[model samples]
Target chain A: MLNKVVIFGVGLIGGSFARSLRKAGAVREIVGVGRSATSMARAKELGIIDAIGVSGAAADGALPLADALHGADLVLLAAPVAQTEAILASIAPHLQAGTVVTDAGSTKSDVVASARRALGSKVAQFVPGHPIAGRETNGPDAAIDNLYVGKKVVLTALAENSETDVERVAAAWRACDAIIHRLTPEEHDKVFAAVSHLPHLLAYALVDDIARKPHADLLFQYAASGFRDFTRIAGSSPEMWRDISLANQPALLAELDAYMAQLTVLRAQLAANDGAGLEQVYSNAQHARHQWITAIEAAETPPSPDKAD
Target chain B: MLNKVVIFGVGLIGGSFARSLRKAGAVREIVGVGRSATSMARAKELGIIDAIGVSGAAADGALPLADALHGADLVLLAAPVAQTEAILASIAPHLQAGTVVTDAGSTKSDVVASARRALGSKVAQFVPGHPIAGRETNGPDAAIDNLYVGKKVVLTALAENSETDVERVAAAWRACDAIIHRLTPEEHDKVFAAVSHLPHLLAYALVDDIARKPHADLLFQYAASGFRDFTRIAGSSPEMWRDISLANQPALLAELDAYMAQLTVLRAQLAANDGAGLEQVYSNAQHARHQWITAIEAAETPPSPDKAD
Candidate 1:
C-alpha cells in the first residue's frame, strides 16, 4: 500500500525500477531525484515516472532534494556505489520518521554501515539490495522497461532492520517483477565477488591482455563469436566496474588467488603433455556447465509449471 | 577444377571439408576415410561426401587409420595430433607421386617436419593447413556443411611446398568457402595462442574457479548472456582441447604468461582503489573490441551487395 516512492539517481536501475512499478501498478506516484538535466528530461520522455518529483525545472521536473521526500513512504537509493553514502547522508534529515530506505548498490556491508550511521534510530527501516540484472549498455536509455521482469533481487538486512522493513523491501521488489532473496551483507559481497565482480574483472583483463599483442589486430580478426561473448562484459562501464571491484576487493582478490591456483594445475597438466588429465578436467568442467544450465532452467520454471511440462 | 580430393581422418573437420566442397561446387568428388563406420555412415547420410572410401570402428568410434589415403589426389591429414605422425608414416609409401599432400592439423610445424621425414622428396606437394573453425559439439554428427563458410583457414608452408602446391591448397580451401590467410607455422601458433588457445584455457579455469564457490549453484543464476558466451568454449570436447592445449603448449604458456602480466596490473589497480586507472584500462579494451567488431562486420559484408542497395 506504499502510495509514494522516492527514487534517487534515476539512471538505468532507478529508471527501470520506475518502469517496473508502473507496469505492476504498485506505486501510484514516483518521485525522481537527479541533477542531470538530460537524464531528467529523458526519464520524463520515456514515461519512466509519472512526473519528475524534485529538482524539477518545471512544475513536474523534479523536487528539491529535501522536498522530494515529503510524505514519501518508501525511498530507493539506486545511485552508484561511490555516491550512495553521500546521497544517504544528504537526505537522512529530510526522510520521514518511518520511511523504509533501501538501495540497489552492488556491494552492501559498507552501504549498510553508512546507512546505520546516517539514519541512527531510523536504521531499523533501512535495507540494502542489489538486482543481478544489467547489460553492457548503460544509463536510462539502456534501461529496458522490463529489465527485472524475472530476475533475482537480493536484499541484505541488518538486525536493526525490522521484519516489517524487510517485508516492505521484498514487496517493493516483487512489484518490479523480481523474485526476492535474502542474504547477509557479508555473504552478499562474497558471492557477488565470485560471480559478478570477478567475471567482469576477468573479461576486462583478458581483453586488455589480447589487445597488447603485436598482431593484436589480426588476432582479433580470427576472434569469433566465442571470444566476443567472453569479453562482452569488458564493454561495461569502466567507472562503475572499477568502483565495484575496489569496494569488493578483499573477496575479489581471494577469488583471484583461487583462480590462479586452478590455472596453475591446468598449466602443469599442459606442460606435462597430460592429455588424459586434461580430458578429465575439461570433461568435468563441461559436465558442470551443463548441470548449471539445467539448474538455471529449473529455477526459472515455476514449481507447478516445471512438473506439468 | 580439382575434381578429386582425398581426406584423411574424416571426423568433424574432414566431414565438414567434404560438405563444404559439395556446396561450393568446386570439387567433383570427395574421398573420405575414417576409423568408424558410424562416422562414415553419418557423414554419407549427411551428404558430406559422395562416397566413403574406407570405414571401420576404432576404440572411440573413430575411423581405422591406414585406409585414409586411398585414391586421394590431394590427401588432407585431419587425424588427431598424436596420430598425425603415425598416419603420415603409413600414407607416405602409398601416396601417389606428384599428388599434393596437405594436412588440417591444428599444430603445423611438427606435422610439417613429420611429413618431410616420411615422404622425403615427395614433400614438395605437402602443405600444412589448419582451418580455424569448430563448435563445442564434435564427431561427424556435429559437423556442419557450412562450418567453414566465412571462416579463416591458415596455411603454413615450408620452402619445399612449391607455389603450385600452395596455390592448390589455397584453391581447395577457396572452393570450401574459407577465407585464406597465410602465416608461418610459428606465427600461426603464437597468434592462436594469444587469441584462441589462451581464451579456452581461461574459460576452463574460470568455470572451475566459480564452481568451487559455496553458492556456486546460485552464482550462475545471476550469470547473464555474457557469462554464457564467455564459457561456451568451455563445453568443447575435453579430449580435443586437452590435445590442443598440450600440442601447442610452448606458445600457449607464453601467451598465458603475457595474460598474467595484464591481470597483475589490473589486480594492483583494484588493490590500490584506483578507479580512474581501472576505467582507462576498461575503456581501452572497449575501444579495441569495437575496432575488432567493425573489422569483422566489414569482412562479412558482401562487396557488390552494398552497391546493389
Candidate 2:
C-alpha cells in the first residue's frame, strides 16, 4: 500500500482518484493541494483526502508542499490542462525519488510536453495517463470511488520513462478495476480531437448560434430532446474546453475542416433538393451509428451514466 | 364522441393518436390505412386500430377507401411527409362533408400547400398540425396512450380552414393530453428548421465525417457518452429526415448558413489563438444551455423518455 499520496486540484478527478485508491486498499493516506481551499477542506471532511496540503505551489505557494510530498508514493495532477505546466513546475522540486507522477488531462500531448518542460531531467518520473471515465459531474462531493471502474485508462509512455514507472501507474489504476490501454501521446491527441474536442466545439457553436438569434426565446420553447442531447456538452466549463481546443489546435482544426466539408456537401444537397443524396448521407450515418451503438451495448459497458472525462 | 376515425399511415404518430383517443374515450372505432400490410395487421392485433382499411390512396390502392371514410369524423395523415400530397388527394374524393383532416408532419408550409392543391375548396376542412411527441420508438408496438402527455402540438390553420375545423383538430390533440400552440405555416417551418432540422443535419454530418475517416474504427472505439448523445439523432430514419430537410429547405438552409458563419468565426479565433474570444463563445453557449436545461427542469415536463417526434 502507498504510504501517502499527494493530489493537486481535488475536484471530481483528483478526489475520485483518492477515493478509488482508498477503496482499493492501495493507499494509506491522501493529502490534497489545490487553488480552492473550500473544496480541499470538503475533500478532507469527506475522507477523500486525509489532509489539506498546499493552496498553491513553490515560491509563491500558501503552504510548504514538501511536508506533504516528502515520502508521497504518487503525485497526481488532476487540474485543468492549462494548469498542468505550472503544477508540474511547482511540485517537481519537492518530489521524492521513486515517486511516480501522472495526470488525468484530456489532451495527452500537451500534458506530456508540460511534464518535460517542468521536470527537466526528472521527467522520467512522470507517466502520462488519460483516464477515460465519467466527468459529467464535478466538485469533491461528486467524486465517487468507482469513477474509473470498467473505464479505459490510457497511458502514453514517454521514451525517457522506465518500464517500472509505467507499470506502477498502470497497476494503481488497475486497483480501481480499470482496464489499461497504451498509445503514443500524438495518437491519443489526434483520436480524442476527432471524438471529444471537436464535438464540444460543434455543440458550443450550435448553442451560441441559436442563443444569439432574434427569435432565440421562441425557438428554445420548441427545442426538445434532440436539441438537449446535442448541446449537452455545450454546458461544460468554458475555460476547460477553451484550453483543450487551443492545446489540441492542429488536430482540432483538421477535424473542424473535415466536418465543415461534410456540412457543405450536405447543404448543397439540401439546397438542390437532392433527396437521394441527403438520404444516402443520412443512411450512412444511421448505419454507422447503429453499428457503433450495437458494439457498445455488446460490450455491456454502459456509457459512464456520465459524459466526457 | 366521434363514432369513427380513419387514420392514414398508422405508425408511432398515428398509432399513438389512435391509442390516446381510445384512452380518453374520445373515439369509438379506428380504421388504419397504410402501405405495410404486416404493420397494419399488427396495429389491429395490438388494438391500436379496430380494423385494417385501404393499403394505399387513389386508383392504385389495394382496397376500397370509401368504406373507411364514409362515416369518419376525422382523417389524420401520419405518414412520411413525401406522401402528404397523395394521401390528401386520395381522401378528398371520399371524405364526408364534415370530416376534419389534419396531419402530423414535421414541416408545415409544404403540408399546407399540399392540402390546398389536393383538397381545393374542401381545404377549408383540412386543419394542418404537427404533433411534438416522443418518436424515439416507432411502430404500433411502441405506441403509448400517454405518448403526447404534456407535449406541445403545433396547429397551423390555413386561411381556408373553418374555425370549427381548426378547433376540432386542436380538441383532438387536447384529448390526447397535448398542449396546443398556434403558428402560421411559415413560422412553424422556420422555427422547427432551426431547432430540429439543423441539429439532425449537424449530427448526420458529424457521424458521416467520422465514419468515413481511415482511422474511424479506432476513433469510434474511444468515443464515450458525450459523442453518443451528440449523435443519437443520427440514428433516426433517413427517409423521414430527408423529407423534412427538403420540405423545409429555405429555412433550414438559412439556419445552416448562420451556423457556418458562427463556425468560421470560431475557427478564426482558434487559428489566431484568441483565447478570450473562444472562451466568450463557449461561455455564452454554456450559459444558454444551462438556462435552457434549468427552465426545462423547472417546468417538470420530462423530455419524452423518447426522442424526436
Candidate 3:
C-alpha cells in the first residue's frame, strides 16, 4: 500500500487519480498541491484529496513542499507540460530515497528530461507516464473515480529507471483499472503527435480561420452537426494544448508536414476537378475509419485483465 | 395545397422532405424516384411516398419518367450532383408549363448551369437549393420528418429564376420548418467551401494519412473521443462528397488555399517553439467556439415560425 501520495497540480488529471486511488484503497492519504488555495480547498471539500498543500509556498493550511513529502511514497506530477520542470525542481529535495515518481503529462520526452535535470541521481525512480483519458471540462469538480477505468496508461520508462520502480508505478495504475502500455519516449511522442497533437492544432486553426472571417456569424449560423463535431476539440483548454504543442515540437512539426503534403495533393485534385482521384482518397479514408471503429469497439468490449509488464 | 410532388433521388434528403411535407399535409401525393427499384419500393412501403418510379430505365413495376411527372406541381431533384444534368434532361420534356422544379444539390452554380443547359426556357422555373442538414446515414431507412426542422435552407436563384418560382420553393422549405436564406450562387459556394467542404476534405485526408502509417492500428487504439468527433464527417458518403468537391472545384480550391495559409502560419509558430503564438491561436479558437455554441443553443431554443417569403 502507498503510505502517502502527493499530487502536484490538483486539477482534472491529478484529482481524478487521487479519487481513483482512494476508491481502489491503494493509498492511505492523497495530498493535493496547486498554486490556487481556493481550488485546492475545493478539492479537499469535494473529498478528491485527504489534505491540501501549496507547491511554491505554503499558505491557507497548506503544507510546505518538504513537509508534504516527508512521508510520501509516490509523487504524481500532473501540472501543465511547461511547468513540469519547475515542479520537479521544487519537490526534488523533498522526495524520500525510495519514493516513486510519475507524471500525467501529454508529452513524455520533455518530462523525462526534466526529471533527469531536477532529480539527478533520484531520477532513476521516475517512470514517465501519460493517461489517455480526459473530458473537455476540467478542474477538481470534473474529477471522477472511473476516469481511467478502461483507459490506456502509457509508461515511457527511461534506461535509468529501476524495474522495481516501473512496476510500482504500473501497479498503482492497474489498481485504478488502467491498462498499461510501454514505449520509448521518442516513440510515444511521435505516435501521439500524429494522432492527438496534429488533430488539435488543425481543429484550432480551422475554427480560428472561420472565427476571423468577415462572415463569421453567418458561417457559424449555417454550420451544422458536421462542423460542430469537427471543431469540438477547438473548445479544449488553450493553455494546456499550447504547452503540449510546444513541448512536442519536433514530432508535431513532422506530423504537420505529413498532413500538409496529404492536403496539398487533395487540393490539387480538387483544383483539377479529378472526380476519380477524390473518390479514391475519400473511399480509402472511409474504409479505414470504418475498420478502425470496429476494432476499437471490439477492444473496448472486455477490458483485458491487468497486463503483465 | 400542392397537388403532386415528385422526388427524383428518394434517399435521405428526398425521403425526409416527402415525410415532412406529408406530415404537414402540404401535398396530396408524393412520388419517389431512384436508380434502385428496391430502395424506391422500400421508401413507398415505409410511407415516405405514395408511388415509386425508376431513373435511367423502367423495370420492376417502376413508372416511366413521363408517368412519374405526369402532373407534378413541384419536382424536387435530390439526385447526386454528378447526375443533376441527366436528371434535368429526363424530366424537361415531361414538365408542364409553370410547373416548379427545384434541386437539393450541394453546389448551386453547377446545378444552375445544368438547369440552363437541360431545361432551356424552362430554366426560369428552376430554383436551386441546399438544405444544410444531414446525418452520416443515408437510404430511406434513415429518413425522418424532423431532419429539416430548424435547419438552414440556402437558395441561390439564377437571373432566369422567376420571383414566383423562388417564393414557391421557399414556401415548400418553410412548410418543413426550415429557415430560408438567399445568397448569390458564388457567395453560397464560397461560404460552404470554407465552413463545410474544407472540413470534410481535411478529415478524409487526415484519416487516410494515419491509415497509411506503420502503426495505424496502435494509433487508432489510443485515439480518444476528439479523434472520433473530428473524423465523423470522414464517414460520409464518398461518392457524394467526391461529386461536391469536384462540382465546387474553384471555390473549394480557394478555401483550401486559405486553410493552408492558416495552417502554414501555425506550423511556423510550432517550429519556432513560440508558446505565445500557439496560445494566441488556440485561445481565439476556443473563445469563438464557445461563443458560437452559445449563439446556436439560443437559436435552437425555439423554432422560428415558418418563414415568410
Query: Which structure among the candidates has the greatest lDDT?
Result: 2
- DockQ preference between candidates 1 and 3, better one: 3
DockQ of 1: 0.65
Q: CAPRI verdict on model 1?
A: medium
lDDT of 2 at A239: 91
In model 2, how well does chain A match by TM-score? 0.92
lDDT by residue (tens digit), candidate 1, B1-309: 666777766677877787777777777777667666677677777777656655334443333434445445677878677778776777667777657878887777667778878878877778889988765556777666788877889998888778988998888888878889999999888877877788888888888777766778767766766678778888877777787888788899888877777877887887787878888888888778878888878878877865885
lDDT of 2: 0.89
RMSD of each candidate? 3.3, 5.0, 3.8
Highest-DockQ candidate: 2
- Candidate 2 clashing pairs, residues 3+ apart or interchain: none
TM-scores for every predicted model? 0.92, 0.94, 0.95
Evaluated at residue A83, the lDDT of candidate 1 is 80
Tens-digit per-residue lDDT, B1-309, candidate 3? 788999988888998999899888899999888887788888988999888876567777778888888878899988777889998998888888758999898898888888899999988888889998875678999889988988889999888878988998899899899999999989899889988999999999999999999888878877888899999999998998998888888888888898999999999999988889999999999999999999889776775577534
How accurate locally, in lDDT, is each candidate?
0.78, 0.89, 0.88
Q: What is the Cα-based TM-score of model 2?
A: 0.94
